[model samples]
Target chain A: MKEIVVVSGKGGAGKSTITAGLSYFLKENDILVDADVDAPNLKILLEPELIREEDFYSGKQFKIEQDFCIMCGRCYQECSFEAIEIVNLNYVIDDVACEGCGLCQFLCPVNAISVSDKLTGKKYVSKTKYGFNMVHALLNPSEENSGKLVAEIKKIAKNLAKEQNSSTIIVDGPPGIGCSTISAISGSDILLLVAESTISGLHDMERLIELTKNFKVKRKGFINKFGLNHSIDEKLVNLFESKEIEIVGYLTYSQNIPQYLKKRVNLPEHIDGYKKLFEGLYNRLMEAVG
Target chain B: MNISIVSGKGGAGKTTFTILFAKYLVSKGKKVLINDLDVEEPNVNLFLNKKLDYDEVYIYIPEHIKENCISCKECAEKCLFNALVVAKDFWLVLPELCHSCKLCEYVCKYSAIKGSKRVIGKIGQSFDKMLHLLEGRLNIGESLTTALIKQVIGKSLKIKDNYDVIIMDSPPGTSCPVIQASKDADKIIVVAEDTPFGFSDFVVLSDMLKEIGKDYYLVINKYIDGEGYSEFASKNNVKVLGKIPYDINLAKNYSFGDVEDIDTIDFDNIYNTLLEG
Candidate 1:
């Protein structure tokens, strides 16, 4: 199956809006994956009903056996992460600060610390009203390993596609060119870059484009809120053309986006202009994948 | 003493704050080192107008040697990221999927797995009399930035003793890179705005700081007239270090790399408050 990931370099670029609209245009059996584990909002627009939920564990959680503990401070000194501390003549492990690197457990003279798995987040497989499977997740606040959660979401999406004989997998990737974005684009067939027209937007887009080029993925651009700065929009178009990247569509600035957010509805329903633009962009993506 | 200017959300004026802080320190005749850990979009150089000297760094991933034919599939089976796929005759390593943990090399029974380095990106540095700038750039397709950021921070460590204070402009979000940049900071100033998104992310960042035992203060940028941001500050029990009102000329000056001319408004109070604390 062909997979397409839509991502923006920074947040507030109307990525979820475009992804929601694209979901409406995709085939009935295609799988949609929301890979933005930090702030997964595509499900809000799609309104997927949770069919299955599972906990995602990435690393170990350290627990101290207080009975065997001596306040030698060896674990505290050996821990590079500063997870161990001496409190009231007893050593304690702060689970949140602990990366579970196992340095303390190995170096502990008393062997008071033991590592165990802890649930970091929950992954959900849901059924959307659009007749497609949607896989998304929520990482606990301050929890690490968003990249690993993103990979797990993709795996579920791929498996769901195979089980249902789906033809496409649509991924709404996280913003930023970090580990989460990397995991989103690593194995994708095409990358759809949704960029804005602000100065920082342009700067971040250039960096993201550089990152996408490294992965050697076929890329296209969608300029969201192009009217914010026409000059920057034109400059971006020129840059994309010079790089041989296609501009799929330019979406004009409109309050319809924020309006849809308040009403918790899809873009195509609230804005006629966006409806047409999304249809065009969806068709172009299909053709590109074809 | 490396200090990073960070916030939990984007558009919190982190770059603006960094530029202003650098200028403030420069005006005080103190040598400062500014490293833009925001490799995804390094804009400090745009405001500084200084040329950068770059050095490339590579993240090594182990490639299995085919000659040592042990198709045990141990590497693939033991892999948590599923980056290695072992076929009946051979194994394939997806470099992009690899997290560079080097666990596969350890799991190989036949010693066939060996690591090879691929240059993912470069860390660039520039120097002015007032400030030294180090910026990291990830290769266009490279997925791993934590490694590159580590390199940038590692290089910045060498000159920490040279300057009285090292200021870092960190990337947005509370991810690994952000954590890495803020790991060794003596103090963190979270630049936040008076918006709901900004408030939410500030809370998340505050939780992280509290957990990590890092002392932090909040600077509300673009403080409007009668906005009651002070009340928010009071409720959170975080001191409002200083406020820069909404000024178009100040923003324009910053965008054009002329921040040094914008009068240092309220920075003395902010710095004093930090120093006193």
Candidate 2:
């Protein structure tokens, strides 16, 4: 099966909207995955019903055994993160501050600190209202293991695609050139970037393109809000021209799109011209993947 | 006062607000330092249009000294990030996967693992009149975002006393990086667009903020007469600072990187209210 991942280096550049549109257009042929585990929003567009759920534990967390009471501040001094803090006069590990590096546990002379598997997030297999299987996850707020969670979700999506004999997997990726974004795009057949026509958009998209150079995947794009700035649009087009990335689509600046999204209406189904636009996006995607 | 402009989702106008507010402070002849903590894809310098002095930032990763005789897998076994691999004859340390925790160096019984510096990104600073811009940019293909952010914040904290107000542009989402950026802020201004994804992520972030007991206010961007965000802010007791009307010209100006005197909202009032109250 082929995998197509949608990502935007800048946030709110319409990655989810494009992913939702692509998934709707692909229909039964594609299994959907939302790799933005921190804030999964494809569920808002697709309206998936939970079919299977699983708890994801990826890293280790150090827990202080309160019964073993040696107040040696060795662990506190050696702690690089300062995760070990005194709360109510008891040396406790601040869950938020802990990086799960297991240094405190190793340095604990009294063997008071023990390590346990950290439940970083939860993954779900759902059946969308539009009749496609979707694999998504939610990284527990403040969890740093989003890259692992994204990799796990992609694995599930790939397995589901194999089981269902689907020809494609459309992934909605997170914003940025961080670990999670890297995980989402790696090993994908195609990388569909949704960039906005803004100065920051061009700047961020440049960084993302720099990131994608390390991966051996086909790069394609749609410049969202194209008419917002004609100069930036021209610059984006010129940049796309310089790079190997193909500009397959351009979405004009629209005020009504956000309004429609706020109401949870499918763009292609409700909007008059979006049907053709998304159809073009899907067609270009198929041609590239093929 | 340290003010952080954050967004629940990407592209929610955090940078836009940050530059606008920084310029506003500059107009009033206040010493303003803008910290762009969005290391992964920092774009605050795009609007600055000024020459910035650059400094390379590095993270330490363990380098295995191959000739140290023993093949004890203690370092590999104890490594939480699984960055180290021990083979029969060779050892591999994936620098990209390393969290720079120095655990491997500490765990090695033999003096085989030594810490070495690897360049992660650079911190750029532009002192343009009253406005100072400090941007942290993570090297492409590098995942150590929070490490660089910590460095940026560390530098900001050292010289923050010279500035009247320090405005930080935090990366989007409610994750470790966002939390790291918000942890040091005196107050946070959350920028939200009035869309479903925006509203949903905002709810998630606000809940996390409340759990963390962070003092934060909401500013609606590209607002289109929407009561959903305002109602939720009221219901959740979150302060709604101001709303930026949906103006294509504002977007256009931002796109052109010419935000010198673009006054879309009452940034002065917002700053005064946040600082005083």
Best by TM-score: 2
What TM-score does each of the candidates earn?
0.76, 0.97
Return the top candidate by lDDT.
2
Model 1 lDDT per residue over A93-193, tens place: 87655656555665568888777887888999999988788999877756767888999999989888988899889999887787788889889999899
DockQ of each: 0.20, 0.77
Q: Which residue pairs collide in model 1, if any?
A: A210-B140, A211-B140, A211-B141, A214-B141, A215-B141
Local error of candidate 2 at A242, Å?
1.7
Writing each residue's lDDT as its tens digit, candidate 2 over B59-127 gives 888888989838888899898888988977779888878888788888888899887898999999886
Which digits, one per residue and each the tens of the lDDT, describe model 2 over residues A1-290?
89999998988888888888877776674699999888889999888999999999988888898889498887888777778889877899988888889887877888999888888789999999889889999888887978989999999998888888899899999899989999999899999988899888888889888889878899997899989988889989989889967899988888788778878988887776998988898988888999
lDDT of 2: 0.86
